[model samples]
Target: MNKSYDLIAVSPHPDDAEIGCGGTLALLSEMGYRIAIVDLTNGEPTPFNDNPQVRIDESLKAANILGIERVTLDLPNRELLDNIEARMKLAKVFRKMRPKIVIGMQGMTPKASPDHYQSQLIFDASVFYSRLSKWEHLFDGMKPWRIHHIFYYYTARELFTQAQPMQFTINISKHFETKKKALLAYESQFRAHPSYNPPIIEWIEGMGRYFGSLVGCAYAEIFYGSTILELNLFKQILG
Candidate 1:
């Protein structure tokens, strides 16, 4: 079944999307938007998680909570690189999904994991490469696809010290609990981590509330745009 998506979020690891934009995803899903998440890595080789399959299972559970499809690539965790090969692999998925909006990681996190930055670069290139018609041979005969919009989500490990101002925010006050439940699906990473501190769910909710406060909402998720977004009417801004 070749399914199309309205939005596709590219995650650096299995749980990155759930941590970064689960609330917005949940709200979008409720609005009847078809959304998918492509995980660049399986997020294995962690201190507590021994079975890679278990992580895949957990990601599926989380995806179900958000009501979106999830795809995991074979890119190695902690060693993601933004190279031609990686970009081509991702381009194939972009062509297949043909999403209108593509969401990815913010590229300027110098203190966070290198995989975060590399994933950003890979997505930036892959989105562009997906529109190149001459890459048919390299991309398994997938047709060219040009996405309309690209946005970046903030990760849990991300520090706000160097945060870029969000261009827009989604009010997820109604779906905030659903986001927490989706994140809790990754018990191996958050619940069982040997050095787990600052309980993850609480922190996620706090951040959501803080961002919501900026927009005068109860809970919200922030996004950084790659280009200026077009507004059709004044009511859109009023909301």
Candidate 2:
């Protein structure tokens, strides 16, 4: 709420954004876009991460790696509910940040985490509610704001067999290493996992390369959007 952001990425937990779209975020940040991440939860109560403060610190580290701001909501993890209250809370953030574009997780997931879908619902509702003038009182005196676009990023654990096709791919080959550094900030979640047989970072990098192959890049991240994106200039689409 300190300053307006050009983009805002909403994450179900502290590390979700880093895992999902860190490379894109880093690229945007490097391009001088004011961006921030809103974490729905501190991502606590895990098998390795019991202390909430540690997770918070790790999230800040990740945000630093991406050179963006990070905000954490006080919603309960693993039991996030997509209700009016949650929508209102996120709407306030939307109004405060006044982002031109908003990004969030794809609601359709065959995974066990209800938090992911709930977070998506909250983001979808909040984007609409933020534009309502009547919600001025609810948003703590902030003016109504409308987001121009919404994009969805994928997480590594999603059941890709039933996943939706990506609308576009961002060539993050230049920023893939930066993304890995940001993800590694979550030591408790990745490095400290009990069954850390397969390195999560390696798998994520491999996935990025695989996605890049589809678009003839070294490494990339995929995104989906319901609305068609209009290109103003041919040069913009070249990159």
Ten-residue region with minimum lDDT total, candidate 2? 157-166
Best by TM-score: 1
Residue-level lDDT tens digits of model 1 in 1-239: 17778999999998888878999999899999999999999988877889999899999999999998889999989899999988988988999989999999775556656888889899999999999988788877888999878888887455442455446888999999999989888888888873654467778888898899998999998888867766665886776
Candidate RMSDs in Å, in order, are 2.1, 2.4
lDDT of 1: 0.86
TM-score for candidate 2, residues paired by index: 0.91
TM-score of each: 0.92, 0.91
- Over 4 Å off in model 2, which ranges? 160-166, 194-197, 232-239
lDDT values for all models: 0.86, 0.85
> Which pairs clash in the backbone of model 1?
none
How much does candidate 1 score in TM-score? Answer: 0.92
